[model samples]
Target: MTIQNRERFLNNVAQHLGRERKTKNVERPSSSLMPQWQVFQHHSQDELADELELQCHSIHTTCKRTNAENLHTVLQETIEELKGQRIIASDDSRNETFGISSLYEDLQKKGITCHIWNSADGQYNLDYAESADVGITFSDITLAESGTVTLFNNSGNGRAISLLPRSYIAIIPKSTLVPRMTQAAKHIHEAEQEGHGVASCVSFITGPSNSADIEMNLIVGVHGPVEVTYILVENR
Candidate 1:
């Protein structure tokens, strides 16, 4: 075909493609305005704890090769063991007013070195947390259905406290426990939209850090904490 004829054919095809694209875009719904779905809710902290226990038990049973067993007892024992191994508890305003001080005192009497990093002092020192045997922090939210803890990096507790330590013990209040990750993520996303910016990092830790990267042999604490203890403060 002649050059002019080829140009006319290409222009017509481009126009047709543009019209089809516009039609598809118009048909699509706006995600921003869509109603956000709620994943899980609990009537009380006891119920949440029960659900968490069941889920953790299932994981422990299925991952039998890993020698996983009795998460509740493990968590409790870990806390006790950490007390003997030097543990630092991050302080928060909510914790101070929510009976955490008494808990800290109890832990201290047991020989745990609990440190209170107030809002005025601000931020966690990665080097300090790294040197510590264990770093304990509280989660803003937790998912009972999956035995997952949701931590906001920028809040009273930073990611370093959880990531830098050899062991991590998180004290989660029952009231803040959700059913699944979907609910937790939605809450965080909404918080970001409201100017919180979703913290620096959002960690969904189900268990201790582990890997089977070397010769397919399982190794724990390769990159992160070897032990992860979750103390569900049911009454509180």
Candidate 2:
């Protein structure tokens, strides 16, 4: 929208909600003038998990669920299936917080060249994430309704790590799974309130990158990963 139109709209909304319109460029909290109806409710853990996998599979993406203890094994198997020589991985603290800190070491032991993404701190030695065959990262939240995984961009989390690779692997903890996008957004906002700070770049990725031409010919990985895998850690 045009700046003038947006400002006028915002002022109207603010006045209707008994709020003062902002005169600066700062973001203002949106008010709910009209009462919100009960539109969505939380789903059971089992339901969310099932729905997430179903949605992912429908789009040709693979979602694997395994016990937390067997995560290392499942991760290794996924890499083996890809048979890629070079892999780029995230060094996000969530890896250790979820109890799988040796992922990088494991990759190195397997003779696969591994690069840790540290773009936030200017450690861009690995350059663009597109050069790697597979990119690995952790998910802070997963929305079951659309089978989407949320990636927070920071020093350790790079957007390209998930989008530029031929294949993307995400380690998702079950506790972070939500029934829909609204709940996922609430969780991210709450986390930010507790000091996670809003992610500068929050991505909701569903399956891999795909596009169809006017001729109806489908092309995968034209702009992003051809294959996306979600390894759900059930015990978490």
Candidate 3:
């Protein structure tokens, strides 16, 4: 109100503005969760697969490397290891894809009940995946740096296959492996440009669901799959 008081108020405002500008801290380097740095690519396919396996183990996920030709054998072994008699799988139209439609035949021969998810089946697939000993799906993008698999939910590619089952097995082809997240993003973006419909839900799963929130106690499989396994195929 007074001249001197007004001058003091203006000075106080100026000081407050200066302090606000000074409060910003230096930006830190990119982290694993939302990395900003370039993803490191493997020198060879073998190197990439090895790196992915090691990283997956570090995160408590089981990972195995196998050839496309022997993927069926490897998959059977994995299912046997889990004592899984009932399995749910995603159906891939491409015969060469890891989620090939004929996998049903092989599982059936082994006396393992396998259900291939279909949009027409709707809730039946969800219910099957929920109680199935394990659920199988293929990944669109695989990140070796973080051992992460990205699954796009669609009418055919049900999210329940990967999210509802107690054990999840993702089949990833070596060609899908990218050194970093940016490369994977670029690939997905390009695919979208060429008429690939981006789905409503995209899930990037690193490992089994875990939380350490309550009293800093460790808990696993609270929200999603209790265990996760990755099968990296060379010819996928």
Candidate 4:
């Protein structure tokens, strides 16, 4: 209302505007003045895979190396190991339930009691899981750097199938096993952007669930699977 008050108000507004401009400038980096850095990029997929394989070997020694030709053999061997121990229960609800159908048939031929349950069926019975030896599931992706398998907990395959069982055997295509987590996150993010809703559950399993909580003694299979074997299928 008064001349002095009007002057003060105008000065305050000018000061606030200046501060806002300065804040934005401080937050933004000057592209022209920024230093350029070199990033070594691999040219071929084999080169990338080799690099990732080395990194993965450092973490897991059991990680098998194979091409598309031997993927079936690898799966067969893994199945044999489970059968020898008598710890495999194939859940073949849908014929499209990853590699379970084949596994189920193989076990059935051998007189193993592998049951098929429908996906539409109600929540999984805990007793079945408790009595079961191992659960088999398909992974959406695998990470070579950490030897991790990524599973989506959705309608096709419930989360309990992987968690409740004492042992989990995952079939993951080698092409899906990325070099790093950032790449994996980018893929998921892009999928979400394309209107596929964020996955209800994204589990990254590197190894069997274990804990050394009691008296500093290590115990496996205390919470989840005691053994986790991954059958990596290369691109065919």
Q: What's the lDDT for residue 226 in model 3? A: 88
Give the alpha carbon lDDT tens digit for every residue of 174-222 in model 3: 8878776777788788888999788777888888888999999878898
Question: Which candidate number would show the highest TM-score if scored against the true structure?
Answer: 2
- What is the lDDT of every predicted structure here? 0.64, 0.79, 0.80, 0.60
Provide the lDDT at 168 for model 3: 90
Q: Considering summed lDDT, which 10 consecutive residues are worst modelled in model 2?
A: 33-42
Best by lDDT: 3
Between prediction 2 and prediction 3, the one with superior TM-score is 2
* TM-score of every model versus the real structure: 0.66, 0.79, 0.78, 0.67
Q: Write the per-residue lDDT of candidate 4 for residues 80-126, one digit (tens) a residue.
A: 76553333333434233333356556766786655443465555444
Give the C-alpha lDDT of model 1: 0.64
Residue 171, model 4: lDDT of 67
Off by over 4 Å in 4: 1-61, 65-70, 84-100, 213-218
Clashing pairs in 1: none
Quality of model 2 by C-alpha lDDT: 0.79
Backbone clash total, candidate 4: 0
lDDT rank, highest first?
A: 3, 2, 1, 4
Instruction: Tell me the tens digit of each residue's lDDT in model 1 across 117-195.
Output: 4445454455567677787777788887778888776645667778777788776766777777777877888888888
lDDT of 4 at 183: 66
Name the candidate, 3 or 4, with the larger TM-score value: 3
lDDT for predicted candidate 3 compared with the true structure: 0.80
